[model samples]
Structures are given as structure tokens and as C-alpha cells.
Target: MLIGEVARRSGVSTRMLRHYDALGLVRPTGRTVGGYREYSAEDVRRIFHVESLRSLGLSLKQIGRALEDPAFTPSALVGDLIRWTEDRLERERELLERLRAVDASAPSGWHDVLRIVELMQGLDSASAARRQQAVLARPEGVAVPAELLVRAVLAESDPNVAGALRWALVRSGGDVVAALAAGVRSEDAGVRRRAVRAIAAMSEAPGATAVLADVLGDPDPTVRGHAALTLGRRGVTGAVPALVGMVVEGAHDVDAAEVLGTLSRDHGCADRVLTALAGELAAPNADSATRIRLTQALVELPGTTAREALRRLAHDEDRAVALVASAFVTVLDERCREDRV
Candidate 1:
């Protein structure tokens, strides 16, 4: 076939076929009497082969090596192509997310779009300070979408930056509870912990209370502990067991004890709290330090049950626990006597 017929049948443009010939990628196998280029069947097949390699994101140079270099193995080159494609896909995904965030912000003009884009870049900066500044320095009255803040909060590892991101979410006044709840359910423990911490600040948000209630059973003890403390302070009685567990385990036991004391304001809840504490103190495996921590926690409870529990602990087997419990009982006695006056 002549060059025109070859281009027609193969769907390769004449200019591109000529370019391939110039590069020795697919030279014509013969010439006609007029000295025009002519292609044999094998030459047309090679043209198709080059187009096939180009479809796999191969550069012209790589395609030349692939077609002409008999020593070239495709395994390494194919692996590199896979990595390059993945990188391009990731970049595209990030760009798409940024565009979505900008659109969600409802930017009023090019200025708003540019500002949102700059803020997003700062949030993604490697420096923690820059990320924090991105959140803190957002132009006042420029409403950043809560979804963007939610993403930042979940992925941020720096404590200060994470706090700023959470604050920004709160300031945005968008309902982020549902998004943060998904983060709470993440398979990554770190992500779940960050989600829990961020959601902890949204206690009054609609659905936040329920989400936190569910997080009480998180497999991660840290996540459970944070959720428990937040719920306990919100006057949710369901957090009592986990709060008591924190006291027993000495995980933020002081804060746990304080919240437990607050929950004990209710007469029925006080009894439950007292009973749980007494059970832990009486456990056969309860160490002296554990008993001591439990004794300290009892001071927060209000009622005869707590006082009587302390009175009993005053004579405990462990001398250290006895001393601490006795001192607490004496203070309770003084306070009770003062109340009588």
C-alpha cells in the first residue's frame, strides 16, 4: 500500500506516519516509481503496535525502545507506568477535592475562589504552623465549608493544628456531626481518636450525643475514654460504666472521677455510682493503688452511701488506702457537722 492507502486503512494520519518514518519507528518497506513511500503489510502492523503502546501511557521514546530494543524487558517499564498512572490519579483526586471544597464554599467571585484555594494549600502544607495558620487566618466572614474542616481535622497529626481545625469547624456553623461520625468509625485507630476528640467539642450539636453514645464501645480504649468523659459531663448516665472503668484503669482517672461526681448529683445515679465503685474496691484482683484511686473518686459522690463506703474503706487492709480513706471520712464528717449548723 502507498502512504495514502496505509494512512486510510490504519487510521494513522499521513503526517504522523511520516513522522514515524523519520524517527525510524515505522519506515516504509518500499517505494513506488514516483518515489512516494510505500508500506508493506508488516510495516502497517508495526504502526498499529506503536499506537497500542501509546495507549498504555508510554512516551514516544519508551515506545521506540519497546518496539526496537530486543533486549528491553517490559516488566520494569510496566511497573513504572503503573506507578506514574497512580500518581496522576492521586493528583487528580486531590484537585477534585479542592474544587469541590471551593464550590461548597460558595465563593462569590474569583477573589473568593483564590482565597479558598490558598487556604486549602496551607492546610495541606507540610509545616504544622502553616496548616494551623491556614485555619486560623481564614478571612473573617468567609465561610469555609465544614466538610473541608472535617477532612483536615481527621488527617491532622499535629495537636495545635488539629485543635485549630476543630475550632474552625465549630465556627463555620455547618453541621459536621455526621462527617466526623464517619471518621469515628474509621478503621484507623488514630483517625477514630482524632474524630472522637473533634466530636467531643460538638456535644450540643444535633446527633452528636447519639454518635458519642455509640462510640462508647470503640475497640480503642483511648477513643472510648474520651467519648465516655464527654458523655458523662453531658449528664448521660450510660457513660457511668465506662467512667468507672477509667477510674479503675487509671486512664484520666482524675477527670473521670470529677465527671462521675457530677453524675452522682442524682440520687438514683449516685447509688449506682457508689455501688460500682464499691464493687471495684472489693474485687479480689484490685491492687492497693487501684483501691486508692477508687477511694479518691468516692469523694466526689454526694450521699450517705459514699460516706459510709469511705467509713468502711477507712479500716481497709491496705495501710495506705486506709489512711487516705480515713482522711476523706474525717473531712466529710466535718462538712456534715457544719451543715447541721
Candidate 2:
């Protein structure tokens, strides 16, 4: 076959075949009377081989070695190609995400596009200060997309930058609850924790409460504790058990106690909160410190049941617990007398 026929059959262009010949990567096995390059069957096969390697991201130089160097080992080269392809794919994915963010922003012009890109780069910056500035410095009237903020919030490890990202998400005013819900379900514990924290601040967002409720069963105690505390403050009685558990375990027990107190103010929920607290206190394994924390939590409750519970705790076996409970009982009595006045 001549060069043109070889190009036609092999799908390698004539110019590329000639270039390959020049580089000695593949040379036609013979020539015609007119001195045009002619390819034998084996030469055409070699052309196909070069094309195959090129498709795998091999440079022409590397292809030359692969085809001609008998001593060349393909294991290392193949491994390098895999890594290079993976890196390129990752870069492409990041670029695609940026483009999607820009598209989602509905940029009015090149200026808007550039500003969104700048903000995204800032959010991804190595310097935490730069990342925060990226979120905080977004220019007036240029809205950063909530999705961008969501990605930043989930990936951010820096506490200050993460806060700024959450603030930006709230200010973006885009419906970010769905994206954040997905973050809450992430296998990464850190991402789930950040997602819950961000959602806790956006409790007013539609479905935010439901998402927090769903997270109450999260395996991470910190995540479930945050969700429970947030829900408890929202007056969702379902959080009572988790909140009581926090008091028992001493995980943010102070905040848990305060929220439990607030939740107990609801006439219907009052007994449930009191009962859960009393149950923990009555548990045989309840340590003195645990009993004392539960006793202090009882003072937040308003009705006689809390006071009665405290009165019982005031005479408890543990001297320290009895002292704390006795003090809280007096405080509750003073509060009751004031309420009557």
C-alpha cells in the first residue's frame, strides 16, 4: 500500500505518517518507481501500533522508544501514563466544576464570569486568609453561587475559613439545603460534621429542620449531638433523648442542659424531658458527675416535677452530687416564689 492507501486504511493521516517516518518511528518498507513511499503489511501494522500508543497519552518520543527500544520496560511507563491520565482527568473535573458554578451563577457578562472564577480560586487558595478573603471579599452585586460556597464549606479544614464559607452560603440566598443534605450524608466524618454545623445555622431554611432530624441518627456522636442540640433549641421534642444523652455523657453538657431547660417549658414536652433526665439519674451506673450534671439540668425545668426531682437529688448518696442538687433546689424554689409574686 502507498502512503495515501495506508493512511486511508489505518486512519492515520498522510502528514502524520510522513512525520512518523521522519522520526524513524515507522518507515515504509519500500518505494515505488516514482520514489513515493510505499508501505508493506508490517509497516501498516506499525502505524496502527503508534496510533494505539498515542491514544494512551504517550508522547511521540516515548512512542518511539516503546516501538524500537528492545530494552524498554513498559511497566513503569504504563504506570506513569496511568498517573498522568488520572491527574489530567482530575484537572478536567475541577475545570468542569468551575464552569458549572459559573453557568449556575447566570453571569450577565464576561465581568461576572471573571468575578465568580476569582472567588472560586480564592476559596480554593492554600492560604486560609486568602480563602476567607475570597469568600468575604466578593464584590457587591456579584453573587457567589451557593454551590460554590457549599463545596468550600465541606472541603475547608480551617475553622475560620469554614465559618466564612458558611456565612457566604447563607448570604448567597440560593437554595443550598439539598446540597448540604448530601454533605451531611458524606462518608467523611469531617464533612458530615461541617455540614451539620452549617445546617444548624440555617435552621430557617426550608427543610433544614428535617435534615437536622435525619442527622440525629448519625454515627458520629459529635454530629448527632450538634443536630440534637440544634433541634432541641427549635423545640423539636424528638431531640430530647439525644440532648439528655449529651448531659449524661458530658458532651457539651452545659449547652445540652440549657436547651433541655428551654424544651421543658413546653407543657406537653415538660414531663418527657423531666422523665428522661430522671431516668439517667436513676440508672445504677450513673456516676456522681453524671448525676450532678443531670441535677443541674433539672433546674432549667419550670414545674414542680423538676423541683421535686431536685429535692430527691439533694439527699443523694454522693456528697458532691447532693451539694450541687441541694443548691439547685434552692434556686428553683426562689424562681417559683418569684413567679408567684
Candidate 3:
């Protein structure tokens, strides 16, 4: 059948089917001799699965990955979702009890305001976790639910959004962060990339440092950069090694460069990052922009450690980079002059 027929049987429109195709949610099985699209009974089955999950609030990108495996279990996924729904329900219940004991329609405090949102289905922990993942998982050009856009905007407005989110991740450290990390594992590159950025920002939360470690090998350089920056800012000294690797692979990108600069500022992390930068600069494939930035970072650091690292990199293959490193050392080398530790 053509896309129109598939759309008719599936109750989804042709344009949406096309969008699904773009998201890899559903694709025709074959093409006709005249170049029209053709689909099979199996394609119809796939569409049914996609539509079924969509009704349950799964994003097209999520449904797309679920369909690739023969062993995929929709019931199990639904059960997980149902559990999340139950948790959200319970939290709202507690919030309501607190609200009723206070004045009519007036929030007693920040927690009271939060409780009202919970009652209205806006601040459910499980639901927020799921919605965040869904928003992060949607492919580029795909439309998102309008309410999500509003919440994301509001989340930014609170100024303490990061603090509140960190509190949530810490308070419910296990499940919420687990769902978010799963979004980062999405096969849709866009989904994985955005999710990783969100995860990176959450590293200060209880379980988040571990979560960022797991994604250090993410396929996209952009995701890795964000992850590296997040971990660096969190100042995970243990993560210094993995972040060092990302910095090497992503030397040309400014995000990684900035992270390395931060790591250099951290007295404990500077040595490892500077050593890693030195090795990367000597390698034949290193980016010139990257080498310069690393050298400049080394020169800019106030610590005696940074100066020593600069001295070592002064013999780099790139003459310009080497000259800068040597001159920086010459200027700041005095700081290390008096019996440096």
C-alpha cells in the first residue's frame, strides 16, 4: 500500500507518517516501480505499535528505537510508566494535605506553591522526569506539546531552577536521574545530545556524577563536550581522566577548551589536565586552535603548577604556539623561581 493507505488504516495522516519516517518511527517497506512508496503488512504492524505507544505518551523517537528489537516488550514499558504515574499521584496527595490545612487558595510558602503545581499535574516528579526525557528525545523539526514549552520557560524563570532540579535529583536520586540518563542513550543523535547537556548540568546532584561518567564515550563530539564541561564544573577529580580524554578528542571545540580551562583553575585537577593537554598538543593531528587555547589557559592560571606545565609545552611543533608558551613561561616563570614545591 501507499503512504495514504497506511495513514488511513493507522488513523495517522500522511504528513505525520512522513514525519514518522523522518524520525525513523515508521518507514515504508519498499517502493513501487513508478517510484511511489510501498509498505507491507509488517509495516502496518509496526505502525500499530508506533501508534499504540504514541497514545501512551511515548515520543516518536522513543517508539522508533523500541521497534527495532524483536524482544521489545510494550507491556513492561507500560508497567514502568504506570509506576511513575502512581508515584506522581502520591506526591500530589501529600502536597494537597498540607495545602488544605492552610488558608483558602493561598500558598503558605514555596512548598505550598510547589504543592499547588503538584495538584494541578504540573510538578509531579515522575511526570516531570518523563516529560523532560520526552522533550529531550524529540527529533529536530518535530513539534513538542505546548505545555512542555511553557514549563521549560518557567523552569528558567525561577532563577533557582537549577537548584530546584538538583534538589529533585538528589531527593529522588535513583529513578528520576535514571530516566534522564536513558534519554541520553537514545539512538536519535539530537535526543541523545540534548539529554546529555541536561545531564551534565545536573552533575552536582547526588547520583549525577556517576551518570556523566557512563556517557563519556558518547558517539557525538557535542554530547561528549557538554558532558566533559559538566563534569569539569562539578570538579570531579576522579573524572579528570575521562574528561582529559574528551578534551583530547574535542580539542578544536571551544566547549571542551573552556572546561579544560576550568579544570586548570582547580588546583587538584590542573596537573592532570595540563599534562593531558601537553601530550595532545605534541600529537600530529591536534587542532591548531586547540593548541593555542590550551597554551593560553596554562599561561593564564595563577598557580605555580600552571606555569610549570607551560614550560614543558614550550617545545611544541607549531612555532607560534611554542613561542607563546615559552614567552608566557618566561613572564610567569618567576612565580616558580623561589624554591617551588
Candidate 4:
């Protein structure tokens, strides 16, 4: 076939075929009387081979090596091409994500679009400080997309940056409770913790109370404890048992005691709190240390139930328990006396 017929049949342009000849990539194997370039079957096959390699992102020089060099191993070159393709694919995915975030923000102008892009980039930044500044520096009135905020809050590892992202999520509010709840269910303990922290930080995280109520049942004690404490503070009586457990385990017992005290202020839940505490206190296997922590937690409870429990504990067999309970009974007596006057 002549160059024209070869170009027509192979779909390689005439100019490109000539360029290939110049580079000695696919030289014509024949010539006509008019001295025009002619291609034999083997040459045509080589032309198709070059085009096939080019489709895999091989540069012309690389293709030349691949086609002509006997020593050129395709394994290494193909692996490099795979890496390059992956890098390009990742970049495109990131760009698509940014476009989605920007579109979700509903930017009214180029300025808004740029601002949201900058904020999203900052949220994903490697430096914790940059991430924090990204959240804090959001223009006052612009609503940063909630999905971006949710992602940042879930992935943020730095305490300060996480706090700022959570604050931004709360302030930017647009139905983030579902995303946060998903975080609470994450298999990664750190992610679950961050999710709960973000949810608890919201003044009114929609569905947060319900999600946290479920989190109260988490098998991880730390997760359950944090969720219970937050729920207790919110006056959810279901947290009383977990709070009492915290006191028994001596994990964040002080904070748990304080929140339980706050919950006990509601007369409806006070009995439940006192009963849970008394059960832990009276358990036969309850160690002396657990009893001591329980006694401390009782100081936060109101009504005669705790005071009466203290009075019974005052004469207990354990001297340390007697000493602590006796001291508390005296303090309660003094406070009652002062109230009477």
C-alpha cells in the first residue's frame, strides 16, 4: 500500500505517518516508480503497533524504545504508565470532589467559588495549623458545605483542629446529623470518638441525642463513657446506669459524677441514679476502691436516699469506707442544719 492508502486504511494521518518515517518508527518497506513512500504488510503492522502503544500513554520516544530496542522490558515501562495513570485518575477524582463541594455551596460568583475551593483545600491540608486556619478563616457569611465539614471533622486528628472543624460544622449547619451518626458507627475507634465529639459539640445537632443514645450502648468503654456523660448532661435518664458503671470502673468518675449530679436535679431521674449507685456500692464483689469511688459519686446525688445510704455506710466494716462515709454524713448534716435556720 502507498502512504495515502496506508493512512486511509490505518486511520493514521499522512503527516503523522511521515513523522513516524522520519523518526524511523515505521519506515516504508517499498517505493513506487514516482519515488513516493510505500508500506509493506510488515510496515503496516508496525504502524498499528505504535498506535496501540500510544493508546497506553507511551510517549513517542518510549514507543520507539518499546518497538525497536531488543533489551527494552515492557514490565518497567508499563508499571510506570500504570502509576502515571493512577496519579492522573486520583487528580481527576479530587477535582470532581471539589467541583461537587463548590456546587453544593451554591456560589453566587467567582469570588464565592474561589473561597469555597480554598476552604476545602485547606481542610485537607497536611499541616494541622493550616487545617485549623482553614476552618477558622471561613468568610463569616459564606456557608461552607456540610459534607466537607463532616469529612474534616471525622478525619481530623489534631485536637485544636478537630475542635475548630466541629465548631464550623455546628455553625455551618445543614443536616449533618446523619453523617455524624455514621461516624459514631465507624469501626475505627478514633473516628468514632471524633464523630461523637463533633456530635456532642453541636448545640442542636439534629438527631444527635438519638444517635448518642445508641452510642451509649457501644462496647468500647471509652466510647460508651463519653456518650453516656454527654447524654447525662442532656438529661437523658438512660445514661444513669453507664454513669454509675464509670464510677465503678473509676474511669472519668469525677466528670461522670458531676453530670450525674446534674441529671439527679430532675426529681424524676434522681431515684434511678441513687439506685444504680447503691447497687454498685452494695455488690458483694465490689472492691474497696470501687466503694470509695461510689461514695464520692453519691455526694453529687440529692434527697434522703443517698444520705441514708451514707449513714448506713458510715458504720461499715471497712475503716476507709467508714471514714469517708462518716465524713460525708457529717457534711450533709451540717448542710441540712444550715438549711433549717
Candidate 5:
């Protein structure tokens, strides 16, 4: 195909194609007798590939590297492209939706006036939900609610969520996090829900882990469970206290199961989880059936600490638990026979 045909088929601009040719990013495989650039089907494929990468925000230099090798696995770096596209698309959709809603609601004589004002903002959390209610109610000036606006930013996987947070609220960075932490305790169900989601998305720090622990007290069970999971990922040793309380004292039953499991598997809170396990075995709290299930869980854990905790439980106060551990001790004995325990 000639340049025009290639441009038509590939939707690549003529100027860009020429530039690509010059940079060897996409080269014509053969030349015509008249000396015009002639591209093969293979060239078209390369063009689409380049365009796709560019659409994903890759620089020309980066696209060139991608073309040269198919095995390129820049895991964390490549993830940035997907995150950027997702965030941009979400923003675009939100703005469009707000525009459409405003258009439908504007009075005949006041279309221009409403356009200068926002139509109505997007709802993210209950705080924002309240603002939306106020908007529909008419004549109440509404910026997004503090809780709802912050929740939206924190739920995002993209770092651009940071900008949304900064733009909506003028609070200092410290205050923003503190408010978000405090949001978990909000009486508004939606605010608590979104706040749990937001904090879960930012679980790289121990301070953030404490916030999740605090949310465990939320009346909403789901919020408590989400907090447990977020705390688990950070391996925050500080959460051990909360985990112990949740699992043993029934401080938050829904959170208890998942958080206790996460403490052992993900957070590496060895001592606390083991102590909780031993306490459950030594003194009975979970029913016979549930305790049996927990016995199976402890058996499969394959960690030496869990094994030692089991050994201690083998001499448990409860004869039933001791019996269950004795049966498991038989398995440990066989492993010892193989020298593999």
C-alpha cells in the first residue's frame, strides 16, 4: 500500500507516519519503482502496535523498546499505563454524566446560568450523597461532602486520586489522613463504607493500619471486615492487639475470622495469631464443629510456629481439643518418620 492507503487503513496521520519512518519506528518494507514509500501488511501491524502503545501513554522511545522485544515485562512500570487510562476514563465519564444531568435539569431561561455553575457533582460517598440530595432539592449551594469527596480519592488505584483529594479539600495533608481515619467512625453508613474502601487502597503504612483497626468497631460488619483485610496486607504488627480482640473477645465477629487468618498468612503476626489459636484450644469459645474446622486450618498452615502452638494444644484443657491434636500429632509423627516435619 502507498502512504495514503496505509494512512487510511491504519488511521495514522501522514505526518506521523513520515516521522515514524524517519525514526525507524515503522519502516516501509519495500520501495516502489517511482521511489514512493510502499508499506506491506506487516508495516500496518507495526503501526497499530505503535499507536496502541502511544494511546497507553508510552513515549516514542518506550514504544520502540516494546516493538523490539515481545517479552517485555516491566510489571510495575507497565501497570502505570493501565492505571492512567482507568483514571482518565473515569474522570471523563464523570464529567459527561454531570453535564447530561445538568442539561436535563436546566430551566428554559437559565441554561446559560446553570452552565456557568456546575450542573451537579458526582456522588461518591454519603457525604457526597447528601450534597447530591441538596442539589436535587434546589437552591442549596453544595460542594461535595467532606467524607464523600475524600472517600472517592482514596478508592482510586491511580495516584491521580491524590490530586482529586487535594483539589476538593483545602485541609493540610496530615488533617486529610486524620479526617479519613475519623471517617471510619462516621455514623453515616455510606461515609463509613467508602472510608473503609479508601483506607484499604492505601495500606502500605502502619499508621494507616491503625485506622483500619479503629474501623473494626464500626456497626457495619462489611466495613469491619474490609478494615481487617487492609490491615493484614501491611503486616502491621500494631494490628495484633486489635486482631486479638476481634478474634477472641468478639469485639467484631465479622472481622474476626478474616483478620485472624490474615494475621498468620499475610501480616506475619506469628506470636499473636498463635496465642489466639492456643487460647481458642485451651479454653472453648468456638463450638465443637467450628473448633474442628479451626483444627484443620491450623494443621494445614505448615508453619513451625503453628505446629508448636498445636503441640502445646495437644495437652489442652479440653479433652476434645487435646484428642483432635493427638490425632494430628499422629500425622506429625509420620512426618517425623520421614524426617520432614
Candidate 6:
């Protein structure tokens, strides 16, 4: 076949075929009387081979090495190609994700597109400070999509950046509750913890409460504990068990106690709160340290029930427990007397 016919059949352009011939990658087997280049069957097949390798992202020089080098091993070259293809695929996927985030933002113009792109890039920057600035310095008109914020929040390991991202999500405030709900279900313990923490930071009324309520049963104690603490502060009585459990486990037990105290102020749950604390204190396996922590937790609860529980605990068999409870009772009595006077 001639160069034109070869180009037509093999989809390799004539110019490229000539270039290949110049490079000795594929040379014509013969020439006609007019001195035009003519390719034999083997030459045409070699052309096809070059085109095939090019399709696999082989550079012309690499293709020359692959086709002409007598000792070139394909295994190393193929491995390199695989790695390069994988890298390209990863880059494409990331680009597609960025485009989708930009689309989700619903940018109105080029400026909006650029702004969103810059913000997304900043969020993905290597510096935690840059990521934080991306969140904190976001301009008023360009809204970072809540999905992006959710992703950042879930992956952010830095406490300051995570807090800023949560703040941004709260201000962005469109269907973020749903986005965060997915985070609460993540199998990664860190992601679930961040999700629940972000969800807790959101207002209780805008479906965050319901999602958090569902997350109360999350297998991760950190996730469940944060959710419960938030819910308790929001006056959701459903968090009582988890809150009481935190007191028992000494996991953020102080804050849990404070929130429980606030919940008990509702008057209806005061007895229940006091009872849960007293029960934890009275459990058979309750060690002296557990008793001491529970004794401390009691100071948060109000009403006569809590006072009476503290009074009984004040005389407990454990000397340390008695000392702590008695001291709390003394403080309570002084506060009561001051209130009356």
C-alpha cells in the first residue's frame, strides 16, 4: 500500500507515516519507478503496530524503543503504562468531581466559576491554614456548596479547619442536614466523629436534631457521645441514656453532666436524671472511682431527689465517696441558704 492508502486504511495520517519512516520506526519496503515510497505488507503491519502502541499512550520515542530495540522488555514498559493510565484516570476523576461541585454551586458566570474553583482548590490545598482560609474568607456572593463543605469537614483532621468548615456549612444551610447524615453513617470512625460533631454544631430545629437522634445509636462511642451531648443541650430528653452513660464511662462526663442538669430543669425529667446517676453510683460493680465521678456529676442535677441522693451518698461506706459527696452537700446547703436570705 502507498502512504495515502495506508493512512486511509490504518487511520494513521500520511504525515505521521512519513515521520515514522524518517525515524526508521517503519520504512517503506519498496518504491515505484517514479520514486514514490511504497510499503510492503510487513511495513503496513508495522504502521498498524505503531498506531496501536500510540493508542496506549506511548510517546513516539518510546514506541521507537518498543518496536526497534532488540532487547527492550515489554514488562517494565507495560507496568509504566499501567501506572501512568491509573494516574491519568485519578486526575480525570478529580477534575470531574471539581466540575460537579462547581455545577452544584450553580455559578452564574465566569467569575462565579473561577471563584468556586479557587475556593475548591483552596479547600484541597496542602496547608491547613489555606484550607481554613478557604472556609473563613469565602466571599459573600459565592456560596461554597454544602456537599463540598461536608466532604471537607469529613476529611479534615485539623481541629481549627474542621470548626471553620462546620461554621461555613451552617451558614450555607441548604440540605446540609442530609449531607451530614451520610457522614454519621460512614464506616470510618474519624469521618463519623467529624460528621456528628458538625451535625451537632448545626441548629437543633433544622432536621439536625432528627439526624442526631438517629445517630444516637452509632456504634462509635465518640460519635454517639457527641450527638448525645448536642441533643441534650438542645433539650432533647432522648439523650438521657447516653448522657448518663457518659457519666458512667467518664467520657466528657463533665459536659454531659452539665447538659443533663439543664435537661433536668424541665422539672419532669429531674427524678429520671437523678435516678440514672444514683443507679450508676449504686451498681454492684461500681468501683470507688466511678462512685467519685458520679458524685461529682450529681452536683449538676437539681430538685430534692438529687439532694437526697447526694445526702445518702454523703454517708456511703466508701470514705472517699463520703468525703466528696459531703463536700458537695455542704456547697448545696450554702447555696440554698444564700438563695433564701
List model 5 lDDT by residue over 1-341, tens digit each: 99999998888889999999999999999999999899998899999999998887999988898888677766765797889889999999877755554453443556444532442332333354444443344333333334434644545333344444544444312335566776676677766766666656656533666777777666675676667656654565555545554544444544555556666776556566666666664554566645554564466444677777678667866678678978897897688779863
Measured on C-alpha atoms, candidate 2 has an lDDT of 0.89
Candidate 4 accuracy as lDDT: 0.89
Poorest 10 consecutive residues by lDDT, candidate 5: 116-125
lDDT by residue (tens digit), candidate 6, 1-341: 78899889888898988898898899999998888889999998888888899988999899999887889998999999999999999999989988889999898889999999889889999999999998999888777778888889999999999999988888886788887888788889999999888888885547888888898887778888998989888789999999988888889989998999999997368888887887888899999988898899888887777888889988999999999999999999999999999
Report the C-alpha lDDT of model 1 over 202-263, residue by residue, as the tens digit. 78899989999998988898999999999998899999999999999999999999999999
Which stretches in model 4 have alpha-carbon errors above 4 Å? 7-11, 68-79, 121-130, 219-222, 278-288, 315-319
Clashes of each: 0, 0, 0, 0, 0, 0
- Candidates sorted by lDDT, descending order? 1, 2, 4, 6, 5, 3
Residue pairs clashing, model 5: none
Report the Cα lDDT for residue 258, model 3: 60
What's the true lDDT of residue 126 in model 6?
95
- Locate the minimum summed-lDDT window of 10 residues in model 6: 199-208
In terms of lDDT, which candidate is stronger, 3 or 4?
A: 4
Query: Total backbone clashes of model 5?
Result: 0
The candidate maximizing lDDT is: 1
**Tens digit of per-residue lDDT, candidate 2, span 246-324:** 9998999999989988887763688988889888889999988888888888888877777888888788889998999
- Would you list the clashing residue pairs of candidate 6? none
Q: CA RMSD for every model?
A: 1.7, 1.9, 18.5, 3.3, 19.0, 3.1
lDDT of 6: 0.88
lDDT of each: 0.93, 0.89, 0.62, 0.89, 0.63, 0.88
TM-score for candidate 6, please give it.
0.83
- Per residue, candidate 3 scores C-alpha lDDT tens digits across 29-134 of 8999988779899888888888888888776666766777778777887888789778988989766644442343355466655543433343334455544443
Error of 6 at 187 (Å): 3.5
Residue ranges of candidate 1 with Cα displaced over 4 Å: none
